[model samples]
Target chain A: MKEHLFEYLLRLGDDSLILGHRVSEWCGHGPILEEDIALTNISLDLIGQATSLLKYAGEVEGKGRDEDQLAFLRLEHDYKNCLLVEQLNGDFGMTIMRQFLFDAYRLPLFEALIHSSDSQLAAIAEKSLKETKYHYRHSAEWVIRLGDGTEESHERIQKAVNSLFKYHVDLFFTNHVDDALLKEGIVPEMKAIHNKWMESVKNVFSEATLEIPSNNWEQSGGRLGRHSEHLGLLLAEMQYMQRAYPNMEW
Target chain B: MSKNDWPLWEVFIRSKQGLNHKHVGSLRAADAEMAIENARDVYTRRSEGISIWVIESNNVYASDPSDMDSLFEPSQTKVYRHPTFYVVPDGISHM
Candidate 1:
């Protein structure tokens, strides 16, 4: 049970770590300067969440491995981040779509996990829930504006939506870690989580004048340490400093 | 420039809804919707505003720098326009 809990926390931590890094790439390259700052703010929030989750995972593992160690030292096969997060930032529309989909899943997941039997997990979830609520709102608003805006924007954003929809299904899929956490009351009901996620996504999509894809096939493997092509390159950049200068710290 | 490169917008933020909007910064966006998004991103990241307004920088009218003296110097001598001319009643506690 302890091992499973640790794995669950690591999955959460890795997802945040990967997505944070991906979004941080847009810090200075946003379409507008204000959006640059906003994306960076969201990235910082995700990184903060990763720190908390990884720190808790370390405590559970009792191996003295800190968040930095977990984040920088992990191999490609060892990472448990969802494939959705490691995806390339093709364009502004793609970025917004990526964020909206993940935020949709995370906001409700955090809301439910706040009541976990594990107080550390609950505390982390409680704090992240506030940030995720804002993240979700921000992304949802952008999705609507882009989808319903000018012809060029509508077409581009809709294309981004269609391409990214395939990855959204992996967010709610329960695995062995989930099974163990459920048994211990360390996590909430997955079916209920899925339902809430669907409702939220549907509400946003409807308002955005976007269509929800009918395809049921979803990509996976992040839970089992598999990832899309993008993860390795992102990890190379993120882990470079720590990997090159082992034991160096300020 | 392509339509994607919208005009520059000046962002004004009110710390609270009832407060006056103050010029905070500028951002380039393709439209009013994007301008508002950019303004929210740039100026309000630190919870600095309760509301935001974005107007195209080109659309705003500004007083010419050469007109500064003529536009303002005469007002200083208009003491009758000042509220200080009114004597407050001694019993007006709140005032």
Candidate 2:
């Protein structure tokens, strides 16, 4: 039970940690000053949630490792975020598309997690839900504007959707960890959440006048820790200060 | 990043329920919705406001700076228009 719970917490925490770092990369590089601040603010909210989650995971693991060690010390295979998050933010359109996909999933996931039997997890989900809702709004609005805007924006955003759409399915990757949490009443059913995510995404895409890819190609393995090459590069950049000078603080 | 022609918007924020929406600043956005969202991100990130209002900068008509004397100089000497002559009763503090 402890092992399953610990693994579950790590999956949750790693998702936020990796995605938070990815989003923070947009801090200084958004398309406009307002967008720059908006992206960084979203990144800060995700990182703040990651801090709470990873800290709790460390406690649950009963290991000496704290949130910092868990976040920065984990190898690429040991990290459990979906490939969708680790994917490069190709352009403003691509970043908006990627974030829209993730936010759609996370909003429902957090909403359902609010009813978890585990009080700690439920509390975290409740707090993170507000931030996730705002993130969903931001990304969803941008996705629509980009998809339905001018000719160039429509073309660019369509290309982004085509490229990023493959990763959306893997976000619902479920196996023993989900089964264990499901049996323990610690998580909502993955299928239900997946359906909710699909409905929401479809509604938004239809409104945005974006087409869904007909091919149902599925990509998985991020949950099991197998990841694309991007995660390694991201980790190298993120962990440099920690690895170069172990235990250093400012 | 290259689209510099996005229209400019003026942002107004109501810090609390009872207050009027005061002009905070300006930002550029593609539309009114985006303007409000951008204003929320830029101005209200630190718990600064409970409501927001945004309008395109072009919609606002302002008095010319050259008209300052004609528009305001006559009112400056009209000190009797001030309502400060009467002291409120002790309990009437908000007046």
Candidate 3:
């Protein structure tokens, strides 16, 4: 039970950590000054959520490791984030599309998790849900703006939707770890969250004049520790300071 | 500076429950909703506000700098407005 819970915590933590890092790349590069600040704020919020979850996971594992160690020292294959999050940020439209999809999924997931039988998980969900609400709104609004804005914006955003949808199913990937946690009421049902995700996506996309690709293709791997080559590249940059400095602190 | 087509909005934040929404800063957003969200990211990241209001910068009309003295000079001598002669009951701490 502890092992399954710990694995589940890593799943939650890694998603936030990786997506946080991915969005942090936009800190200085957002389309405008206000948007730059907004993206970085979202990044900080995700990283903060990751910190709490990883810290709890460390305690659950009864490891000497702390949140910093779990975050900055983990190997590429050890990360459990879904493939959607680890994908590269191609453009502002692409970034917003990616965030919209994830935020749509995350908001409902956290809302359901707030009722978890696990007291600490419920508490974390309650706190993180507030921040995720804003994130979802921000991204969803951007999706509408970009998708309906201009001929160029429409094309770019549509391309983003088409390309990124291939990884959408990976968001619902679950395994024995999820099974055990579900049995114990420590997590929410993935099926319900998936339905909610689809509904939210349909609403936002229709409003944005965007469409999910008709193809039902899917991809998976992050849950079982296998990851794209991109993870290795991302980890190298993320872990560089810690690897080189050997536990140095600012 | 306006970096993109989005219009600039002036942000006002109420720091606490009973406070007035005070002008903090400005940012560019596509519309009013984005303006409010942008203000949240820019001005309230440190729990600096409980509420926010945003208006387009274009909609605000400001007094000319040359009129500063004319607009304000009369108030300088109006010390009666300060209520310095009032005797207060001691229990009113905020006053």
Candidate 4:
């Protein structure tokens, strides 16, 4: 049970940490200065969540490992972030689509987790829910605007949606860690979370006049430390400082 | 580049409930709502404000530079317009 919990938290933490790194790459290169700031703000918030989750995972593992060690020292096979998050941030449209999809899942997942039997998990959920709400809204709004605005925007955002749809299945995979959490009442059923996520996405897409792709070949493997090709470069950049200067602190 | 570019907006913030909104800085955004959000990210990451306002930079009309002396300097000597002439009751605790 403890091992499963540790793995579960590591999965969540890696998702945040990797996505935060991807988003942070937009810090100075966003489509606009305001979006640059917004993306960075979201990045910082996700990284903060990652730190807390990773720290808690370390405590649960009864290891001397801390957030920095978990984040910087973890090899490719050790990370459990989803391939959706680790995918390249190809463009503004792609970034928004990915954010909207993940935030859709995360908002409801966090909302349900607020009632977990684990007190610390509940507390983390409570803190994260507020930030996740804003992130969901922000990305959902962009999806609408880009999908419905100009012809060029519509085409690009539609392409993004089509390209990313295949990764949706991995989000709801109920494995051993999920089963244990379910039995312990620590994690809500993924089916419920998936239904809510789908409804939310559908409503937003309908309003945006965007079509939901029918692709069903969902990708998985992040939970088992498998990832797309982009994560190594991302890790190289993110871990540079900590790797170069061990135990460095600001 | 043209498709990627969004309009620029000036950000204003009210630090607390009763405070008036004041201009803090500028950012680029696609629209007013995003401008407000960007303003929050740029200006209030450290709890700097309780409220935000974002306006297109072009929408704002400023006092002419030539009128700066007449418009602002005349107020400096108007300190007599200040309420120092009146004395408050000693028991006026809130004042």
lDDT of each: 0.87, 0.90, 0.92, 0.89
The residue ranges of model 4 lying beyond 4 angstroms of the native Cα positions read A240-250, B1-8, B57-95
Better of 3 and 4 by TM-score: 3
Candidate 1 CA-lDDT value: 0.87
Task: Please write out the lDDT profile of model 1 over residues A1-250, one tens digit for every residue.
Answer: 8889889998899989999999999988987556778899999999999999999889899999998899899899989888899999999999999998899889889999999999999999999999999899889888888888879888988898788888876787677779888988889988898888889888988888888877766787778888888899998999999999997787
The digit string of per-residue lDDT tens for model 3 on B1-95 reads 45667788999999999889999988888899888988888899889999999999989999999999999999999999998889998888887
| Model with the higher DockQ, candidate 3 or 4 | 3
For A1-250, candidate 4 gives per-residue lDDT tens digits of 9999999999889989999999998988987656788899999999999999999999999889998899999898899888889988998999999999999999999999999999998899899999999999999989999988999999999999999988888777678889989999999999999999999999999988899887666788878877888888888988899899988999
- lDDT by residue (tens digit), candidate 3, A92-191: 9989999999999999999999999999999999999999999999999989988888999999999999999988888999888888899999999999
Task: In candidate 1, list every pair of residues with a backbone clash.
Answer: none
Each candidate's interface RMSD, rounded to one decimal? 2.9, 1.2, 1.8, 1.9
TM-score of 2: 0.96
Docking verdict class for candidate 1: acceptable
User: DockQ winner among the candidates?
Assistant: 2
Candidate 1 interface RMSD to the true structure: 2.9
The CA lDDT at A148 in model 1 is 81
User: What is the C-alpha lDDT profile of model 2 across A166-249, one tens digit per residue?
Assistant: 988789988887898898899999898899989988999988899988888778788889999999999999999999999988
Q: What TM-score do all the candidates reach, one by one?
A: 0.85, 0.96, 0.93, 0.89
Model 1, residue A121: distance off in Å is 1.6
